[model samples]
Target chain A: MASLKDRIGVIKLNQKVAKDIYKMVLQFDDMPDDIKGGQFAHVKLNDKSHILRRPFCICDYDISAKTITLCYAVVGDGTKVLSSYEVGEKLQVMLPLGNGFTPDKNVKKVVLLGGGMGSAVLPAIPTSNPELEYYTYLGFANKEKVVLEEEMAKVSKQLTVATDDGSYGKKGFVTNILAEDMAKLKPDVVFCCGPEVMYKALKKALEPFDVPIIVSLEARMGCGIGACLVCNCKVKRAGEEETYVRVCVEGPVMKLSEVVL
Target chain B: MSNLKVNIAGVEFKNPIITASGTFGFGREYDRFYNIEELGGICTKGLTIKPKLGNPPPRIAESYGGMLNSVGLQNPGVDHYLQKDDLYLAKRDVVVIANVAGSTLDDYIAIAEKINGSKSDMVELNISCPNVKEGGMAFGVLPQSVERVTSAVKKACPNKPIITKLSPNVACIADNAKAAEAGGADAISLINTLSGMAVNYKTRKPILFNNNGGMSGPCVKPVALKMVWDCYNAVKIPIIGLGGITSYTDVLEFMICGARAVQVGTYNFNNPYGARDIAKDLATYVEENNMDINDLVGTLILNK
Candidate 1:
């Protein structure tokens, strides 16, 4: 449930973490039980001029601090407003929207694949419980496009990096690395989030793998609720029939087999 | 204080401000943000006899001043609504207006029968949606069919106030309004979203999956006002004006142009508190000008 009054929560700009990414931490006084990964928040900028709330995915949350971080790219008019705020400046944000990834307890090994901006959210799952053996595979166009390598390295058991231009670790692609290491490491589950092109490539490459796979899709959402069926994904349900369910409600995360890329 | 009450075909409202159909979904979402009882009324989502999955992806596209939507009347069906939706809206204090759509005459009759026995305040017969392929445009575009459907629904739901929502896409809105009136409609709501399309320049393809969608928001204001005025002159019953109403200024413009009341639609996307804001502004405007808000009704002056 969401409302215009609760459309934005008072937030304080904590720090400027990286280029194009600001870490605005909000005080969740009576925060909802769980702010799951892959779920998003709608932040309103400029109480008067802009009426619509802009959507963003949660980067990290600290219960002790009563704060959650939103890492965003400065792309459009809304982001321009978000980028102009200063430290300690009061901001408004709606929280923990959409569905998050379902982490399995029985899994022994985990592989998290992210490309470019998608890397912002990968740290949460690994840092939540450090006992699990986690590996990260990061895909970037070149060295300049890479982000959060050090932060990703801190949580995962091993960090594997790849760039298309061979400006970093592996010269080829993450899919090639995934193909090579599919047997020895034998990850029980694969969680991937990235651009459409990268996800499409992974969709084809990971078809034969026996492990359960989950994909986080990105679509232009209007309401960020079930009412506006704008953010819909074609899903192949059981019985070989296909139908569309809202990405904002049913998921931003679903089983790879259930979705049509 | 200025007699905010309004009764259309016997269904009385505390005020004249209402959350338009498709904009406010059965009052649950909007209720979470504010007290829904403050408003005059609400129109539930367009209902059909059977569950409709709606159109495909890219169902909505952002235009310069507004948006184009082709969300093909997606709903859980009339039976489910009567069985479950009534319980949700029953607790709310505002007048309930059920907007019903259909693919056939029987579909309309079945939904009307459901509304006949329900707690809904008014039955707004929506034969005006331009996005759907079937009964939406078919029943609305032709005056003969409009009269037929309105008559049929009036017969089915004898007790309910029947407000036939008119499409702006038709040749003459005034003639169509008269047709609804002749067919036994107690009231009328004008200017449903205008049919329009947006093209993706780079891809040389339409932005929406349906190729065309209903244009709404600030862009359609003038067109809506004209239709409201046109229909106002031709009909004796109250006209519920709608189309691209974002601000109180727009609401005033509609009232002055001869609308008894108005519905706020696409503006809900940009501002969820749009209806309340408009209500406040309208009250202020009425007070500042020292003119009766009701007197603003049918004040349109047509130049020959």
Candidate 2:
């Protein structure tokens, strides 16, 4: 269990990377050198109206520069406020929160699937484990929403992009493409992070493969620590009744089979 | 350091800043950010006779200057807490206050009996949880029920002091505080979250899974302060004030109004190190003012 800390991070960059999505790079003097793949940063906004801090997955971290990059969509009041922050401004954030993805050491082949803003967390996978053979599948609503292709490509052995509208890449759902490539890819493990709808579809699409799947779930959180119990997800344990686990603690990342989703 | 020590009932706290129940989970999670022993006391999450899974997804909704929570009392039962968390909490140099909730009188008694003479320094009777369907807010709304529940728990736990936590949703908050004191409660803590609800306009439905939730944060400070003041004047027993407490200034305000100690609730979520920082700031404030921390309690003057 990595210890969580509140650090005042200086925003080095805050700019739009895609439609309605902006990327922020923050520099912290005392951040942990290594943050897990699926871990997120709980960012506090300047506006007092929004009491709860917004949780965003860590897109990447630069240890040498002591910086962490976060990519988020301007969906709510918190993000809207965050988008307006300029460089040199101090942002308070709790870092390296929740249980991140655990890549199996014995597994040789890996598949990473991300959708929309979910693509933000995929880039860290290959960066953390450079030895593993990787395949990336990214899904977007349209071509305009697509992002992080060049960054993910630098790390993945094979990268595939899918859009709902046939504007860029394949014309269909990313899970459909995942289904087609499962046999050929024969990935030993699969990691996914996206919308709830995508997880529901991927749960069925990857059911036949018998490969272990890890997923990073997102929820509106009060305290990004385990205390508040606001961000809960149903998890079914072996030989026990279904129970709720805090997404901020037990996971943002969990085994597909363990989660009730 | 200006005599930060304060005694609640027979239990002694190093300072007047205790982490509120439900916000601090057995002192482990927040310990990662700061030392739990830095505070005066820690109130564990609302424990029950049986383990609770709590409400479904979307248990929280952010409101103006506050947030609503429908996380009903989610805990691994009193037995589990004693078995797993008691030893760990006991080893720490802080007072451990067990905050217990139940659906029925027997449920309260069962948990009280389990915690009696345990490692817990005190028992905080949480009869004001609004998220549960039965028992919680019911026992807290009326003065008679509040007295009944407080007396029952007081009888059950003979060794530990019982602090009845009163709800603010009632018609008269001071009457409930006096009721707890009349029922043999050792002390009183007031202004548990006020019952409220939030809606998503697009869906035209409540945001919380439980439909209604308890609202706590800076938004409830004035309401909490008044309740604490009213309760202080109503009862001779000490009052632990809470409701949207965020900083040392809020703590001072609560103390001056009549709270012997203040509990940091929703502010814990906003900043994990809030209690620690406030404690330090309070010490500095006391030193700068050239007064002991005790002198600040119940110092508010009524305007003629």
- For DockQ, the strongest prediction is 2
In model 2, which regions exceed 4 Å deviation?
Answer: A1-3
Q: State the weakest 10-residue window (summed lDDT) of model 1 chain B.
A: B1-10
- List of clashing residue pairs for candidate 2: B217-B244
What TM-score would you give candidate 2 relative to the actual structure? 0.98
Judged by lDDT against the true structure, how good is candidate 1? 0.79
Candidate 2 DockQ, CA atoms = 0.77
Cα RMSDs, all models: 3.6, 1.4
The lDDT of each candidate is 0.79, 0.90
Error of 1 at B85 (Å): 0.9
Q: Assess each model's interface with DockQ, reporting 2 decimals per model.
A: 0.36, 0.77
Ten consecutive residues with minimal summed lDDT in candidate 1 chain A? A1-10
> Model 2: how far is A142 from its true place, Å?
1.5
lDDT of 2 by residue, B1-304 (tens): 4578899897889899999999988888888888889999999999999999898978999999999999988888999999988889999999999999999999999999999958989999999998899999999999999999999999999999999999898999899988999999999998889889999988999999889999999999999998898888899999999998888999989999999998998888888798999999988888788777888888899999
